[model samples]
Target: MDKSLNTEQVSVEPQEKRAAKPVDRPFLAMLGMLIGGFVGMLSETSLNIALPSLIAELHVSIGTMQWLVTGYMLVIGIVLPMSSLLQRIFSTRSLILFALCDFIVGAVISAVAPNFAILLIGRMIQGIATGLILPLMFTVATLIFPPYKLGAAMGMIGLVIMFAPAVGPTLAGMILGLLSWHWIFWLFIPFLVVAFILAAKFLPNVGDISKPKIDWLSIILSAIGFGGLVAGVNLASDSGWGSPAVIGTLVVSLLVLAWYIRRQLASKTPILNFRVFKKSQFTTGSILVMLDFAIILSSMYLLPMFWQNGLAIPVALTGIVMLPGGIVNAIVSAVAGRFSDTISTKLLTTLGFGITIVGLILLLLASSTSPMWYVILAHIVIMMGVPLAMSPAQTFGLGALDQQTSGDGSTIMNTFQQIIGAMATAIATSLLAFGSSAAGNVSHRIAFTNGVHVGLWFTLIVAIAALLLSLTIKGQKWA
Candidate 1:
């Protein structure tokens, strides 16, 4: 069977493609996407170290500074629901190539950004590419590779995503150590150009090309609903949560999202499989994943600002301190599945959150006067805790679905995690802003650390909530 359309009978098979191409061509087919994924995720995490500097140079408050991250995520969240529709409408090669070019333009705009508005505009533009590329990577792999090679390809894709975060901070650190933050954006151009070249050369046009009815309603609801909620929460710090703007947006967002859920449940071909929530195991597991994601992103947002802006730690040193955690996280994640086979998902998950709780406590106790050991040890512990829980919990969640909806299960998981992660960071900014205000008449470092403690307390509460959910996870995934 031809690898391109063997199992995919939805479209006619490619007529006269390179039947005698290199056997490794499938790997080549995936190379552009893998590099693109790496660049996207790497840019995501690497910027945490740059946030403090950006805030200082850009003349923005903590609340405004967060748009740099949350805005990027928000755009991705809106784009995810439209991915299925997009995959059917455009060929994989065209979508990816366009996204890469879009990313390069965004990078250039960001590199020369003279102010916060331009910088945010650049980041949001870059986000469109990440959002498009993310789903396409998996879709392309599932398309070009036969079943026997599927697992390895997926694992490699997952690893590259993981590996970027592992290396992103350190590399960004080294670059920032020698140069300004603008260089961070500049660094992507060379790699992206190479990826664009490989993609143009090796990527076969994959996926169905039929124009499905554009589900404008689902897309609109998803965008407005998720976007409004994040915007509301993001606004709450500068404007109190009681402010009409915050309250109004939050209420309207919830109402719209409820309608969106109802519409999806009733549709014959819902874009998202909200029905996956019917399985208790999947629901429990998803909450765990989202919470763990929240924990990770909240920390990523806080720690960089806390260390640099609050405690006066240098950018390079801060990245170096967090480096061990990232490396350990990737290693533990790689092996977490094997251990899940031996240990029950319930116990592994509970234990992982238990460990995470301890880490959060360690961080909670840290302040401006804390030693370097405190930050390093606490970060590594938190890092260790997340993968320990996330991998098995995700496996256990996705396992509960009937094979038919398993794809939906994965899509739901990814979509919510992105929204939740963005929300958590915005909330952290709110807490930080409130804490700083509440701590009037303090030194800058002391004020910043105090605000971080407030955010840490909130993270601790989230971890506890996750731990409680972990305890409820039954051995039987269906229940």
Candidate 2:
């Protein structure tokens, strides 16, 4: 073996001493993670494309169809925090199998459903499965790979996760154009099957199974609290912020969250180790990540709409235009992850946000008649910066914890990303909804511009928040 490979194996040996067998190839493990991550993200993005078809087929209103989007996101957001416990209790094999089964069942149900409500039920089921799979991918990848190689591995996977979904609409559009929307659901089954077989055959069966007993109360409290919080945020996007329904949900969510915190602090075997926040790097890193994701994801969700609806481009062309940005961002994210081990995450993260802010500023100057290349260039800059920021920020965030607690920390970071994505979705959707109605005074072109202007400003605000938070990250290297 090469000396470097030998050194890595030697370092990993102690960590895997308890395993029945060493993982066959860490790269293979990463491939499985990449597949799972790709599929999980694709499920959401493809469904957005397929939604119009489903609505026409089922005779549902747009408002009812909105639930399909909200329901899936809400479930995933709520269940992500519970993944820490799942990682502790279930072996990688069992968890992967469980999540795979969940995706299959939900996909089948949605495919065959007679009504919108039934399809939603299936979507909720699928969301939970996806929720579990998301963090598990990171946990398994982290466990199998040495720290030094984690960034490259995670970056590659992150690229697939981020860019694969950009192709979702194209794929879904092709499928919808050729066959029924049900084929979109059918499309996922084969991928899930492959992921399942690979996971069962090659994935390790390890976990943080040291806890003596499960803490049921903590699980319930966390679920309800996070669920209510996401729901309140989602409701606010559709309804007014001051609405009774939103206020009531927010209040209940806060109360439940408080109780959950108290319970975790007091419990003998807590689901997550809240004490990890003591590390200043971890604290600041998490906030930076949350804000970064909120801005980036919201922009991703909103931009294609501007192109398709505002700019009069076809959906296929929109997907094609968006592809460059997605691929660029994904590549940058992986490169930044590798560089993070040597450079300061603070610098990389700040640079990432700075680039993104410039992109948004450029985007603000755009009109419906603006050249497509300008829009593409704006996104490319943002994408370039993201790679600099995302992986390194995550590595820094999770690196704060001791090895034994890194799993918990990883769960927190993933959960935070999911929540930010969910919250951003709610906020962006609400802004679009409200802005469309409020822009009646402007000409159609200017009205479209105004809506995007408002939304981009929100994204800019999120980017600035991320930039400010990035300043707090310690200039430290992690092995």
Candidate 3:
């Protein structure tokens, strides 16, 4: 039996015609996308380590260092909706090729950047490129592989994409330990070159959609809405939530978002069809995805800081501490993906979140005087919950849509992922900073502990909310 298609009989000829050529190298093609994922995620964390050096060299304030991150996030959030439009306009083959070139250019600019401003420009370009690359890769995988194969293919994709963050600190630590910060940006040049080579060799010219005409007004509105929303979240974290800058930007964001929706509803050729939300499964699945990211991303930000500041470990050691958890999460993702086909998603997602909360509670009990085993056990338990939760949540969402609509649905889900990540990170970081400031003369240990406690409790609440939502999601088996 062909492992690619469903057991239930369907017309094989159209599938064969649409299928990748006999010569198509699926794994090798997958490697190229994995490399893109690695580059995108590595760049994100690597820069965090490089920021202090960046500030020291460029003589910028703490405020300014944020642009290196915030600007990249803004561009990513803004360009994400365009990904589905691009796919509808251009084939996955062409879009991936073009996105790689954009990424390479952004990388080169950053590699040679002499000042902070140039670096910001380069980072923004790279973010937009990443926005295009990630969901496009998922869309392509769904298109090329048979439905049965999608689970494993998507599982592999999940490993590379999600593990990048969990493991980024370790890799960045090693790089920062051995070389200057500049090497981080320069490193991707070679990978981008390799990705280009693979694209020319094994990637097929699969579809014939031309570039979609730009909707400038919608684009402008989306940019304003997403940008203001993210900026408001960040500002609210640092500045008081009541501050004019924070409140005003949030208000503007809400208004623009409303306007963007109206535009989509009115236009025949909207940037992203708001109609996707009308589907009950898609809408519910999207909410679960958003909540999942909000939890995972904020936890990523908080965990590393816990190891580094709370325990007073070096960056390298922090990564070492997290190594087991990252490895466990990777190992479980494939299994979770397979299991999702057989079991109820609600049970798995609830179990996953509940386990994570338990882990967090254990971690909360941790102190510098705690035994190494205790710390390791707590971290491992937390990490174990991720694959258990994420795999089912993601598969259930995408599975709800048919192939024609999958591209658009996948892009929307990923866009929300990035948006939630940025918001959660900003909020968590701000809370940590504020917590530390408020606890003056307290030992760094105590201050950090307080921050982690607050953050973890907040996440716990979020998880409980997600669990409740997951219970309401009607599971549909795709594989």
How many collisions per candidate?
0, 2, 3
State the C-alpha lDDT per candidate.
0.79, 0.74, 0.75
- Candidate 3 steric clashes: 3
Q: How close is candidate 1 to the true structure, as a TM-score?
A: 0.86
lDDT at 328, model 3: 84
- Residues 137-223 of candidate 2: C-alpha lDDT, one tens digit per residue: 777766766666666656675665556555566576667556777777888889888888877777777676654577777888888
TM-score computed on alpha carbons, candidate 3: 0.89
Query: RMSD, each candidate, Å?
Result: 5.8, 4.0, 4.1
Clashing pairs in 3: 4-146, 89-209, 89-210
Model 1, runs deviating above 4 Å: 1-31, 138-167, 198-206, 337-343, 402-404, 476-479
Expressed as tens digits, the lDDT of each residue in 266-292 for candidate 1 is 987787768889998889888998898
Please give each candidate's TM-score.
0.86, 0.89, 0.89
Off by over 4 Å in 2: 1-22, 49-64, 165-167, 173-180, 442-446, 477-479
